[model samples]
Each structure stands twice: as C-alpha cells, then as structure tokens.
Target: MVDGAIAGAVGSAALNVVSYLDVAVRARPTSSTPEETVGRLAGLAHVDLGPEDRAANRRSGLGAVLGYAVGIGAGAVLGALAGTRRMPLAVGTALLGGATMATTDASLAVLRISDPRTWRRSDWMADLVPHLAYGMAAAATLNRLRPPSARCG
Candidate 1:
C-alpha cells in the first residue's frame, strides 16, 4: 500500500511535468475542466463553497486534490493487484495509462465537463502524452519497490 501510494505520487509528478512542458511548448492555456468538474460535483453534493470568488478558489484547489486522489488511488489499486507479480513493462504501462485516462475521461464525461468524442486530435495528444508518462513512472516505481523475489511477468 505504501509502495503504491509512493509510486502514485511519483507518477503524478511525471504527469504534471509533462503537462507543464506541453503547455510551455504550445503556449496553450491550462484546462479548466478540473475546476469545472469540482463545481459540478459540489453542486450535486449541495455543498456551498461560500462566495463566488471563494468557491472558485476552492474548486481550483479541490480539482487538483481530486487529481492526486485519483493518482494515488490508482497506484494503490495497482499494488494490490500486482503484489509480487509484475507485468511486462509494455503491457503494464499501457494498462496503467489506459486505466488512468479512462478514469479521468469517464469522470469528466459523467460530470458533463467534456465530451471525449468531441475532442480534437491535438487535445487528445495533449492528454495522452502526460498520462503515458504517468504510466511509465508509476509502473517503474512499483516494480523497483518490489522485493527481489518479485514474480516473473
């Protein structure tokens, strides 16, 4: 569990770094979908976030928090499932990336924040690159933390 969470944090960092680099290179504005998702969720829960400005601030922070929760949760799940067993790196990374991407995309679609079907090629690329980085980092970290008695793929 601890290993999973640590791997998740590392994965999240990689995702963020790649995302930031993409933004820097493309000069694109950051996505507000995360914050929008936060607002929609809060509305559903009937939790008032105070004033307009305050609510916006809260959403921003919570959006980021939600991201971390997902990352760490994904990692924890991975650890539980993998245990001493390891998947081939190619297989593992794709599974991890696809799983994370699905979770995020599904959540956003469910919240009516964004429609995957409508995303542009560039948009997909922007999302995919960072997520792949996440998978690579998280999978590698988990493998490294495994005992030398690690199970063969």
Candidate 2:
C-alpha cells in the first residue's frame, strides 16, 4: 500500500509537470474543470464553502488535492490488483492510465462538468498526454518497488 501510494505520488507529479509544460508551450489558459468540479460537487452535497473569494480559493486547493487523491487511490488499487504478479510495463501503463482517465472522465460526465462528446481533438490530446505520462511513471515506480518475494521469476 505504501509503495503504491509513493508510486502514485510520483505519477501525479509527472502528470502535473507534463500539464504545466503543455500550458507553457500552448500559452492557453489553465483548465478550470477542476475548480468547477469541486463547485458542482459541493453544491450537490449541500456544503457551503464560505464567501465567494474564500470559496474560490478553497475550490482551487481542493481541486488539486482531489486530483492527488484520485491518483493515489488508483495506484493503491493497481497495487492490490497486481499483488504477487509481475505485469508488463506496457500493460501496467495502459491499465493504470485507462483507469485514471476513465475515473476522471466518468466523474465529470456524471456531474455535468465537461462533456467528452464535445471535446475537440486538441482537448483530447491535452488530456491524453499527461495521463500517459502519469501511467508510465506510476507503473514504473510500482514495479521498481515490487517486493523481491513477489517476483514471478
């Protein structure tokens, strides 16, 4: 569990780095989906976030934190699933990336945060690339931390 959490943290950092790099290269404004998602969830939950200024700030922080939670939780699940089994890197990456992407996209769709159906190619690219980076990093890290006793040989 600990190993998986660490791996997930590493992957989350990788995802952020790739995302920021994209932002730098494209000169596009950062996506507000995270904040919006938080807002929507809060509303549905009947949780008040305080004044508008403070709420916005809280939303931003919560948005980023929620991302990390998802990444870490996903990693832990992957770790549990791969216990004592040596999954190939390509397969592991695909599984991890697909899982994370599906999780985020599904939540957004359910919450009406963003519709994938209307997203352009560029938007999809933006989402895909960072997630791939995340998968690659998390999968590699998890494998690196695998217990020797668990190796398939």
Candidate 3:
C-alpha cells in the first residue's frame, strides 16, 4: 500500500509536468472538461458550492485536484495488481495508459463533459503523449520498487 501510494504520487507528478510543459509549448488554453464534469456531478448530487461567484473558482480548483486523485488512484490499483501478477514492462505501460485513458474518457462521456469522438487529431495527440509518459513513469517506478526476484521481464 505504501509503495502504491508513492508510485501513484510520482506518476501523478509526471502527468502534471507533462501537462504544464504542453501548456508552455503550445500556449493553448487548459481544457475545462474537468471543471465541467465536477459541476455536472455536483448538480446531480445537489451539492451546493457556495454562492455563484465563488462556486466557479472552487469547481475549477476541485477539478484539477480530481484529476490528480484519479491518477493516484489508478497508480495504486496498478501497483497492487503488479505485486500479485508480474507484468512485462511494455505490457504494464500499455495497461496503465489505456486504463487512464479509459477512465477519463468514460467519465467525460457519461457526464457529457466532452466526447472523444469529436476530438481533433492534435487534441488526441496532446492527451496521449502525457498519458504515455505517466504510464512509463508509473510502471517503471512500481517495477523498481519490487524485489529483484519479483520483478517482471
């Protein structure tokens, strides 16, 4: 569990670094999908986020936090599984990336936050690269933390 938490934090950090770098390089606006999703969920749950003026800001902040939470949660799950079933590096990386993408896409689609089907090639690439980095970092970290005898091929 401790190893999983550490791996998750490291993985989430990697994701954030990639995202920030992309923003710096492209000067593109950050996606509001997270915020929108938060708002939608809040609406559904009838959770009032204070007054309208403060609600938007709170939602935006919470949205970013939620992204990190998801990353960490995913990493923890991956780490836990890796402990019991050894996976090759390549396979582990792919699994982490795919899992992360699937979780995000499913949440967004179900909440009507964004439809990946409508995303441009550039948009897809933008999302993919960082996630790949995240997967690599996470998988590598988790593998390194395992005992030599337990490490996968």
Name the candidate that leads on lDDT. 2
TM-score of 2: 0.95
Residue pairs in clash, model 3: none
User: Residue-wise lDDT of candidate 3 within 43-144, one digit each (tens)?
Assistant: 999999999889999899999899888888888888776674456768767888778878998999888888889999998988888888778887777777
TM-score of 3: 0.92
lDDT order, best first, reads: 2, 1, 3
Which order, best to worst by TM-score?
A: 1, 2, 3
Per-residue CA lDDT of model 2 for 112-148, tens digit only, reads 9899989999999999999989999998899889865
lDDT of each: 0.88, 0.89, 0.82
CA RMSD per model (angstroms) = 1.1, 1.5, 1.6
Candidate 1 residue lDDT tens string, 1-153: 778888888898899899999889999998898899899999999999999999999999999998888888898898888877766667768877889999999998998899999999999999999999999898888888887667664
Model 1, TM vs. native: 0.96
In terms of TM-score, which candidate is strongest?
A: 1
lDDT (Cα, 0-100) at 123 in candidate 1: 92
